[model samples]
Target: MGTLRDAMGYPVLRAGIILLVLALLISIAGLYRVDKSYSSSGTLGEGMHYLGDDKFENEYLYHNRTLTLSSTNATISLLQGSEMYNYTLVNDSVTLHPEMRPAIYVFNGEVNYTYDARAIDYPYAVYSIGAFVIMLAGIALSFIGYTQFLKDVKGGKK
Candidate 1:
């Protein structure tokens, strides 16, 4: 590498080296910490109030009653670790009708959750391989720039 560098001036090679370092740093950061999230289904109903430990609640207004049910299921989320990840919990299935046996059964409302995963599913080995490729490309670009600068100097063409 120094042999090629002797043909290329110190200053231009230094600049290329600086740019190469920056690119490599950026590529490494991109592969460092990836994350994800997920959501699931549950049952909600009308009555005393809390459901599924403490996740859901019941509210009454003007003698009318309603329930909010929540369920937990394994999910793949992306915004679990950072402030940039924002998600909304919208109920996909809200209403459950009364059952035929009125004495023993009642309405069963279903609530759904929308959340992010704590980590991405992709293997670390794959991400490392990709980062390695990016680093090589960055170094190659720096060397190419260094050679082009030397070529300009030799031709006396600026």
Candidate 2:
């Protein structure tokens, strides 16, 4: 630990660098999100049924001929955590917009009975927070070893 070169090779410094790399990997994993797709038959909005929860970013609607979201002019209470998105319907296929926008869809009581949707379920990542903590710890530890080496090189051991 007599020079910066020696400090870079110090065991603590090496461990800190390893932790930094691990943190980077964890952060990357955090960005990787998996979308869930599913189809449901029967009543989409009748009696009581939920679409998705806050745990989901947003649910994209894909309507087939066997599906109509709600009865014609049915009241959709936005206060219930359910929102609308802009979408385009071609033939029997529905494509949701990538960005969220206030677009009301009225099915006019079409005789479609099945609803399929793709939802991005992850709104938060525990791995990202963990990676941030690891990064901070690694920087702190690396600097600790760096200063120790610098002090030894200056012959100011106290």
lDDT of 1 at 56: 15
Task: At residue 49, give the lDDT of candidate 1.
Answer: 23
Residue 5, candidate 2: how far off, in angstroms?
4.2
lDDT per residue, candidate 1, 1-158, as tens digits? Answer: 23555644556456657656765666666555433322323432322222121111111111112222233321112121222221223432222221110111122332342221122433343455565665666577667766776677677644
CA RMSD for every model? Answer: 15.4, 7.3
What is the model-wide C-alpha lDDT for candidate 1?
0.37
User: What's the lDDT for residue 83 in model 2?
Assistant: 51
Off by over 4 Å in 1: 34-43, 46-106, 109-149, 152-158
Candidate 1 scores a C-alpha RMSD against the true structure in Å of 15.4
Which 10-residue span in candidate 2 carries the lowest summed lDDT? 95-104
Stretches of model 2 off by over 4 angstroms after superposition: 1-5, 42-110, 122-124, 156-158
Which lDDT value does model 1 have at 78?
A: 17
Give the CA lDDT, 0 to 100, for residue 91 in model 2.
Answer: 42
